[model samples]
Target: LLEDVKTVNIGNEMAVTLSAGIGMDGLSYAQNFEFARNAIDLALGRGGDQAVVKTSASITYYGGKSQQMEKNTRVKARVKAHALEEIITGKDDVIVMGHRIGDVDSFGACVGIYRITKALEHPCHIVLNDVTTSTKPLVELFQDNDHYEKDLILSSQEALDKVSDNTVVVVVDVNKPSITECPELLHKAKTVVVFDHHRSGTEVIENATLSYVEPYASSTCEMVSEILQYIGEHVKIHPEEANAMYAGIMIDTNNFMQKTGVRTFEAAAFLRRNGADMTVIRKLFRENANEYKAKADAVSQAEIYRGAYAISVCSGEGLPSPTILGAQAANELLNIRGVKASFICTEYQNQIFVSARSIDEVNVQVIMEKLGGGGPLNIAGCQMEDVTGTEAIAIIKKTLDTMIEEGDL
Candidate 1:
């Protein structure tokens, strides 16, 4: 169909071109339409002017060579925010959850969800797991606050046991079904609403009753913050919760220096007016001496490549958890002159973790996905089993080389 469409020239100066998406083997017509819609999005996301086909088992792409145009998203966000409120009001209970081993962005978004549900007078619980050192300070702050009801934070097992037909699970920050705090809970819940700012991966929660994912936002908190505005003027965010969301936008945007945009600052301003404390947010970012030293050590091991990229492998016996250090190290490497993309690979918890950060010119998510992980274009990470940090770095380098050769970098 695309070839036939392209064969015609509407005018001497204008040639006709078409992009098509095909979907098949779906159990229902709705599922088939969704697959076709996603396939077309993939075709356009990879730079349009092509045809893409989606099946139950595979996705095939062809003839994409043009650049994609940037879209205006504010209107779309408002529409989804309104739709989300309707879904929440209809549900009996709302359970909020983020990715496992949550980060500030994840926790911040979760807090935002909790606040939204509270305003709606719905029963809400935040499904939490063991957090990394990076989230400890803020988590402790929330735990100490009287307003942050401790019992509302439950374990994955507890959340799963509470799930019922009328329960709505709100997954934030991360959208991949497998990485959510409780994939089982997500599967068990009758209604699911997802709010995420990360690039959608292949293994996403396709069955969400309401899905609000905007990859261009600075963080999931940024997306949530915007949604908060549409919930109701009477709805309010406590200082602690506002602070958490602010910290989320700060960390994800590298303190408004990385992917910060108009909406990012708008959300930050709204939080500030609602009593978000900048001083507290600054305190939340302060790392202990030991963790700071570890981050510095990771940065010290960095090696620059491809003139604009940096890679660091932190390997030693009994080092601190690599999850936080790797992320901090990746962020730190970006501060170095001439580095547009940075990758930090470290071994922790019997697995190799890779954190990748980059400017818009480089889509680190694509690179991370190549290593069996996914995230936004600017930030991404993956965990590798049975691989040393050195081995992971080698694999990253090989992937980078391939991307360069294919003009994908």
Candidate 2:
């Protein structure tokens, strides 16, 4: 359980509840988790049972977690947002690129690129490597329809054959360049536009012409929805495209429950207004019996801790789609009562991928970041180098303990 309080921050070490209670300042649940971590270090060591909250009205607090005497020094750092915008008034040919295996969200973002390019009256091509099938129906729709033509959506070899430095690359849903489904296009393109909702890790395209990344948004679909809207009212979205984007939004937001925000609802409302059928979206996400069995087994293997749960670990068995199903499993486990934090660890292409989720009591992004992962406060994801599940689990536990001990749990 968690509580909230809105009060002035008075200077100095004052007693405050440290474990998990509303601080004198009204911090949101996510903020509370973050504050708990900060308070633990300050109040716990400074003769525990006192909190030192530093806010606008000056620092003050009351009762912190039981601990004792030490000096609480200030940590000052200036973090700035990188340059996010620039308009290239000229139009040119473009290519679409994404991660190793395209998922619904990334594919949906490609749809955004299509819309933007069409509005600009620029020629565009979407590169499809060996693994684009993971995105499913969208591929078939684009293939069967004559509207796609030979202009857009090419195979890996075809892309390499046609791509040139003049090509404007639009990377969707993913930021890491090292693991891109196609690296040739990224190397060949002179101008690039990246749109994604994932937390930034080490690998990102540094020279992108226009990059829009908002990890706080529910999905890349939501991000793309905004970009498409900005493009204007003329671009028509076919039924399949509309439904695919809707499906992407639905999948990323867990049917609009986990990471729903004002912008997310607005994006959904736009898709609904655009004639996207909810029934089609519902059908698109339906899985077979084997998938259901896997999800159920994954949940059964979950372990619970103090308001936190290591709900599922990725086993390579997800086969055709380890990340997608594994993400679903982790999101499902979050629905369990008392599970304040949810994690999904899966082995994807020999790399350990971890997705973390949190409610008010935990900051999943911070935890992921501490372990070379990154994301927003509520939902964040990361990939571990090449570690076994057992080693990864130990690292996770130690990180959780450190977070809890420092009051950030």
lDDT of 1 by residue, 93-164 (tens): 889999887889999898888898899888888888786666777778777577867677889889888889
- What lDDT would each prediction earn against the true structure? 0.80, 0.65
Give one digit per residue, the lDDT tens place, for model 2 in 257-281: 7667777777778888887899766
Best by TM-score: 1
Clashing pairs in 1: none
lDDT score of residue 343 within candidate 1: 94
Pick out the ten consecutive residues of candidate 1 with the lowest summed lDDT: 63-72
TM-score, every prediction? 0.87, 0.74
